[model samples]
Target chain A: MAEKVIAGRTIQVNDEGYMTNPSEWTREIAAEMAKEEGITLTDKHYAVLEYIREKALAGETLTIRKIGSSGIVDLKEFYQLFPGGPLKLASKLAGIPKPTSCV
Target chain B: MATKEEYPLKKVLIICAKGNLEDVYAALVMANGAVMEGIETKLFFTFFGLDAITKKRMNCLHTATVGNPALRMPGGLPFPTLLGILPGVEAGVSAMMRKEMDKLDIPPVKEFLEMITAGGGEIYACKLAADMFKLKKEDFTEEVLDIITVGQFYEMAGGIGTQIIFV
Candidate 1:
């Protein structure tokens, strides 16, 4: 486990850089992480992030194409927003565990 | 700000070295999964993997049943190696595999590639393989990004947070 200081708030993160405790996540933390990923947080990105958090809170397992089919964003836009790895990166930014099916 | 190299596990590069139905699908599933995970994903096709993107063979790909230890009949019966060598057996097995994939609503090879590329995945073919097979650039589907040498391939794979997977 590793600790990250975002907005003067300390949060626990896994070795993969995912927040280990969802309760410690905040909009400030998300913004900080997004900046680190070279993205400027926009409403579109927030919509996807919040969608992930909502589904994670409800105990759902999400895959890349699942989000593509969600109609929040098309597959192409999803990739554009989260270029490297959409589901894993989004979940990490959203303070959720990496989706098990991603690997 | 952290440099790109400092980032751990940034992108995924999947190498599809086999052209068989199962092998190509395995690579596709993983690459597509990576993209959905918001990971940057690139797939490199080498040797027989070229069949996956070849316009003529992509749709006609077949499952390899011969000497495949993990293959089983529809009823969970073990697939006998001897039975796999018989005429039409491989095609039957391939048809069965396609049917199962259809039941799961999996897309066909071409469509799957389209979906992956549209989702921001990159696709490339091996230059050596293409030359050996006498394939020209126009011989492949529109989704292929380029035909590159091994050296170029490694260079592309070299990046922070990038993981190279062989399937």
Candidate 2:
């Protein structure tokens, strides 16, 4: 019924549990959130976030375990760059209407 | 933005069966795309997929040729399997793929994985596959979140707006 900001992205949830601003969020918002999370934003981060956001908008879901198995060797450094780490960054970026029970 | 009753697949599970460059890259691209679109993504490595995450063999991924329609020979000729077995065949293909990926500014597999995971996607190893491959948990990518079975994978994938993909 109201718009809420989760991970720097505005998401509107209806009474029937639907998302209004599903695709409104952008990679820029993800970057801003990363900065707000006290992680320095880099071109690499932008690239990754942009890629992720694009996929999610295309109707795909991502998991931390999948991300880890993707062979990105610099995982620790990347997570260290984030305050809450990759999962938080992704959850924030996804603009999920509510906190997931799994997390 | 108007609330849509049905959201697109908000979660994805990528099943990796081969560890070749193309296979691994395909998985990464999908995962990256999922994260970008605000979806939760996961990649499951089984069989040869483990090679892509294994530090020792990650850089050694080869090209697929047998029964591949995309295979080509010099001067537009079709390359035979014998040619594919030549010493530099795999290396040459791998190099070309890397070059193209570089031109597109795609990060290396390792970095791309990091970005996806760090962005909120999860990465897991198939426990059966790992055991079959005689791989210890330590042999997997350092970023691996867990080793799970197919049932566990299904459990994670269960929910509305979830997709399961094999690559």
Best by DockQ: 1
lDDT of 2 by residue, A1-64 (tens): 8775755667675653334465666556555555656766776666555555555666555544
The list of candidate 1 runs beyond 4 A from truth reads A1-38, A57-59, B1-15, B29-42, B82-89, B95-108, B115-121, B131-134, B149-167
Q: How much lDDT does each candidate structure score? A: 0.85, 0.69
lDDT of 1 by residue, B1-167 (tens): 97654465668989999999999999999887766655778999999999999999998789877878999987899999999999999988898788888656576899788778887789999999999999978999999999999999888787668889999
Per-residue lDDT tens digits for candidate 2, residues B1-167, read 99869766778999999988888889988887676555888999999899988878876677776656687765677868876777887788777778776665566777777777766788999999899889987887787899999899988988888999999
TM-score of 2: 0.61
How far residue B131's Cα lies from its native spot in candidate 2, in Å, is 0.6
